[model samples]
Every structure is written in structure tokens, then in C-alpha cells.
Target: MDVPYDLTSYVRVLKLASTPSWEEFSRVALIAGAGIVLVGLIGFVIFVLMSVVPGSTPA
Candidate 1:
């Protein structure tokens, strides 16, 4: 591996990368939050179904 070349490439990426704007960050956060809530809701539904249905889960 070329250490100097790798270091230069890493530096170039760091130079180009910038923090997200507030609006952009908020949109990302909202989408991520929705996805998390969605997954949790699905899991809760599954748990309720398993608890209510007979023989669906091991006693």
C-alpha cells in the first residue's frame, strides 16, 4: 500500500466534506425518526399478535 498516496486522498476527502445545513439535517433527522417509529410499531404489533393468538408462541 502507498501510505503517502493514501494520506493525500484522505486529506482531499476531509477538505471536501462539510457539515450539513440545519434544514438538511432536520430533514434527515425527521426521516430517521419516522423509520425508527415505524419499526417499533411493527414490533409492537407482532408482540401483541403473538400474545393474543393461541399456540403462536411457546409457553
Candidate 2:
């Protein structure tokens, strides 16, 4: 493996990268928060369904 080459590439990327503006950061944060909520809701629904199903062994 070419470790030095990989490190140079990563360093170049870091040098070229810029911080997100407040608006951009907020938009990303909102999208990420929505995704987290949606996943949690889906998991809760699945757990409730499993608990309510007939003949399922209790945990």
C-alpha cells in the first residue's frame, strides 16, 4: 500500500476544503435530525408490532 501517497492526497483535500456557511450547516443539520427521527419512529413501530403479534415469545 502507498501510505505516503494516500497521506499526500488527504492533505491536499484538507487544504482545499472550506468550512460550511451557517445556512449550509443549518440545512444539513435539519436534514440529519429528520433522518434520525424517522429512523427512531420506524424502530418504535416495529417494536410495538412485534410485541402485539400473537404467539410471539416475550423478551
Candidate 3:
């Protein structure tokens, strides 16, 4: 409804934003990396279980 009015301040704030510090960037990267690893491990475990367990799948 009030598109331009809302985006006006948001655009100004983005224009004034600065690059992330090394510490901040590294923290974000570490969290993202951990999330990716966790998902990958979960997928690998599911795959192993599928092959190792009999009648575990639906027909």
C-alpha cells in the first residue's frame, strides 16, 4: 500500500551501510559452514541407513 514511503528509509539505510568486520564476517561464515556440514551429515546418515536396513522403505 505505502511502497515508496516504506522503501525510502530502507534505501537510505542501505546506502549508508558498511562492509562487515573480519570478526563479524568470520562468525557468520562459521555458522553457515556448520549448518552446511550438519545437513550433509544428516543426508549421508539417511543414505547409509537406507542401504543397511531391510524393509525400511515403503512399497
Using TM-score as the measure, the top candidate is 1
Model 3 misplaced regions, further than 4 Å: none
Q: Over the stretch 1-59, how does candidate 1's per-residue lDDT look in tens digits?
A: 99999999999999999999999999999999999999999999999999999999987
51 Cα displacement, candidate 1 (Å): 0.8
For each candidate in the order shown, give its overall lDDT on alpha carbons.
0.99, 0.95, 0.96
In order of appearance, the predictions have TM-scores of 0.91, 0.79, 0.71
Q: Name every residue pair that clashes in candidate 3.
A: none
Report the CA-based lDDT of candidate 3 relative to the real structure.
0.96
Compose the digit string of candidate 2's lDDT tens values, residues 1-59. 99999999999999999999999999999999999999999999998988899878565
| lDDT, candidate 3, 7-36, per-residue tens | 998999999999999999999999999999
Error of 2 at 7 (Å): 3.4
lDDT of prediction 2: 0.95
Residue 23 in candidate 2, Cα distance off native in Å: 0.6
Query: Could you tell me the TM-score of candidate 2?
Result: 0.79
